[model samples]
Target: MLELQDAFARKFHYLRLSVTDVCNFRCQYCLPDGYRPDGRKSFLTLDEIRHITRAFAAMGTNKVRITGGEPSMRRDFTDIIEAVASTPGIRKVATTTNGYRMAERVADWRSAGLDAINVSLDSLDPRMFHQITGQNRFHEVMAGIDAAFTAGFEQVKVNTVLMRGLNDGELGEFLAWIKSSPIQLRFIELMQTGEMDELFERHHVRGAAIKEKLLEAGWQQRVRAHNDGPAEVFWHADYVGEIGLIMPYAQDFCASCNRLRVSALGKLHLCLFGEYGVDLRDLLQSPGQQAALQRRLREALADKKATHFLHQGHSGMTPHLASIGG
Candidate 1:
């Protein structure tokens, strides 16, 4: 079987496929004003996505994460989920969403074989959520959270981007909320990606500081034998769930990177902060081209950058996160 190995000898097992570059909420750090997509097809059809997944699964990929401006925005989102989940050799399939419309489909998604769900919820307060997301649907998102838990989905994570002078003041609230819930809360360092150059400088919060606050508040670090990704997870003695800090900019883990991103346009992105990728969409459009697609995938994987420029000097406004399925 084919296996994707980078120059650093890291094995790749995770793939994030962005089905759409359009989103409902306009989060400041993600899609600010003047942001535009590459004008590719609105999304990859179910068969196209399945073909791509089959190709990747042939190469030892066991995990697939469906990402989007919002995956639920698609009318046939559950069909996409089922197709991926049923792919051979794929052990798990998940999604990341804003959760504005997630409440209505929790049961459907779970039945469709969604292994997990990550919700982008920077602030719990209605005003703060609206100001940050350009939407007044905090209640709806909150309802979605409730519905997710109620639907019997075992793993639901909340991704909170740490932004100073924005939602930073809600750390205590976030911690308290997660303490009593089954959902894991992951605090992400505000990254200077997409149209977030100014926002990163103005609101970036060090991950160490967030960890310090958590430690001070009695959250103890649990040394795990294995970690899912970049996030360093922690937990309080009494809590059943975990709190994670994802500091890609502060801590360089590129040597151990095991994931690649497929954009809505069908380009394979090697790194989040990378400026280049291999176009797999056109390659897969023609029948009997799986061999060529696999060759291109291997070529791109072999040359994957050892590390991102964001960890070196300045992380100045990288590619749009929506397109890359952040």
Candidate 2:
């Protein structure tokens, strides 16, 4: 049986897997100028990722999310999705993408039994979007989102990382757009990681400020809560879909964090803000290491910190969100 941690009674079963550390767009917050990995390394093969995921599923993991620098960038993304979706014990198979190439692959993704999609769309304004993501393919992302809807993705969640001076002014505009769309919009508080210091200096918007802005704009917050994730969700009375706030900085969710992260290289990260991870690639390579993998996983979970100190004003502590499977 999977042992439960005392810090948080919730049995840990969810895992976020990063398919690759390479992303098409260099978002300012995620990858600032002059940033590079220590050295070039090979990404986990499709078969390798599948093997580790299947082991985790067998060990009682039910939820799995495929993330990346951009999961869509992988040529065999659909194949990976199908493998995880077909896993017996896996209950949820989702992916977080920049949506640049989703339009062309939405149908393939949906047909592969992928559960849902979470697209990172920080701003709707073309120029602003380009400024934030450093990509001229904003239109492509929008089209991809439409394609996902057409492909019948059950719950298309839009993840917007809010920064104070950067896109905070557009919160109302985003909410207005969400009001008209069926997709759920989630506003995430800017945390101190990645190019966080510089990004924070440039944009770092807080959750409290966002909530105040919403309340002042005549948007009444409905009390209906959804999901066991970190996001504190609320609905607008006039809209069919709801808005969510993931306050990782203001109010930490580490205590109730049931998610674990697996990097593209096969390292397992217990928390989003954690500084270290355990390498599972070697274990996966050896049949004799199967039992060892489970034991290591449990050890990582037990060592999971109650909360991250990023909110407490730390630097160079955790890996970039993109590299760590944001």
Candidate 3:
């Protein structure tokens, strides 16, 4: 087993893979102008993705998440999912998508052994949804959620990145919807990255503040979900599902973070807030580079920063979330 440590001595094991930098929608938080589809030859081939996934799986990675500019947009998405799911040691095979295209493929995905899904749904209002995603497909996303549930993917997660002026006021409404549904709702603090400043201002809502608000609104915490990632999860006493807070900006989770990121082209990033990454694609192509690649990955983890320096009024040396899987 391979053990890698960050600056704070946290052991890393999870890997988030971005299979494509292309997406179907232009979410304000993800791609403001919609990601142009890179030529098919530019993205990582299924074989390359599987090779790197198998390599990491062999080195003690149990949790693997497929992300993208929007993972659902890829033509060979199911093949990639099956490849990762079939990797020997991967205990969890999850994916994050915009949810627009999931309705048609939910059964297909589940049949391929997908574990769970994290759907990005920012607003409930049609106009606001269109404004946020630059697409008029909110209804499609909602349908996709239903399809996922019908397909037996009961552990569906909804990720809502809370922007101050945009979707903060709708938290109660969104939470109410989540309470009525079977999916968990996760609210993420806006981070200062990509075109963050141009699109929305960082709200910096601390996890404590959010908890207080929920309490004041009569929602009681049930218990934290026993999971590996850093989100603080809570449940409403009267609700069917739970709520999660990903306080990356206000309260960093670097101390307990076990996640690493693999870019669409197969570069391994040790930290989401850091710019550095090791090219694993080269290793897959070379006959004798696997051992060296493992050493380089471990060394990168050893050098991981204790906390992202974004709160110091400076965005850390990290690539855009689309470029690096988030």
Candidate 4:
């Protein structure tokens, strides 16, 4: 079977496919101004998504993560999940959401063949959650998590972006909540994107501090899976759940990259901070274009850099994480 291999010999088995760029949240770090329409073309159609997934599966891709400004915002979100899950070689179908309608809709998504889910829950405090996300649906989102386990999900991952003067002091609260909740709470280091440089400077917190605290309390790091995301997970004997840290600024951060990304606009992004992307929408118009799509993907891999230039303060074309489903 053929695999998508880059010049650095990194084999891509996971694909983060953004279905839409429309999000309703006004998270402080990502979209404090809320989602504004740039009037770009419509996102990939259902047929286009099917063709794209089939082409990727044919090239030995086994996992597909549906991402977006908020993927569930699409009326056809469940249909999209079913389409990817049914692909011949695709084995895992996952999505990242903000849990807006999760309480009311997760069971339906689970029934549609979604294998895993990651929710953006920045703060466990209801008032703090509101302050951070610019929304008052904190209780609703928490209930949505309960709905996930009730719907048969084994583990539900939560993404929390760590910041200095905001929710950074709640690490102990988070650890206590996950002690028996079966949640894989991930603490992501606040990254410097193009538009949020000022905010990044004001709130950026190093994940190493939290790591040190965990180590002092007896947390042990675990080996990462071949297709897992870039999280350094740690487990503790007293807790039923685990903790993961995503420190993008760490040296050799991209050395173990085994995934690729395709923006909702049908362009393939070689790196999250890549300068540009290659258009794949043209080849996704028909079923007969699979072979050509595979060839294009292979050609595009050669353009991926050995590592991103973020350490040098170059954010490339990414103005914000919501634009490309970061």
TM-score of every candidate relative to the true structure: 0.93, 0.91, 0.91, 0.99
RMSD of 1: 2.1
Alpha-carbon RMSD, each predicted model: 2.1, 2.5, 2.3, 0.8
The best-first sequence of candidates by TM-score reads: 4, 1, 3, 2
* Model 2 bad stretches (over 4 Å): 3-7, 34-39, 215-227, 286-288
Tens-place lDDT digits, model 1, residues 149-241: 888886689999978999999977886786768878999987776556677889989999878877887888766332166778888888867
Which one wins by TM-score: 1 or 2? 1
| lDDT for 35 (candidate 3) | 71
Off by over 4 Å in 3: 36-41, 200-208, 217-227, 286-289
Q: What local distance difference test score does each model get?
A: 0.82, 0.78, 0.78, 0.94
Candidate 2 residue-wise lDDT, 1-326, digit = tens: 56434256656677788998878787877875523655768888987877778778877778788998888778999999998999888888888898988889889998997888889998989998988888888899899999998998756899998877778788668867878788789898777775467667667777877778667765565553222457766766787667788887665466567777889989987777777778888887754576788778777776777777775676334657787787
Residues 59-120 of candidate 4 have per-residue lDDT tens digits of 87899999999999999999999999999999999999999899999999999999999999
Model 3 Cα lDDT, one tens digit per residue, 1-326 = 77655668676668889988777777777677667555653768888887777767767788888898788778889998899999998888999888878899988998987999999998889888888888999999999999999999867899987776777788779877977787788888777774565553545445567878877877765553323566777776688888888887655566677788888877787777776677777777653666777777777776777877777656555535676767
Runs in model 1 with CA error above 4 Å?
Answer: 34-42, 216-218, 222-227, 313-317
* Cα misplacement distance, residue 2 of candidate 4 (Å): 2.2
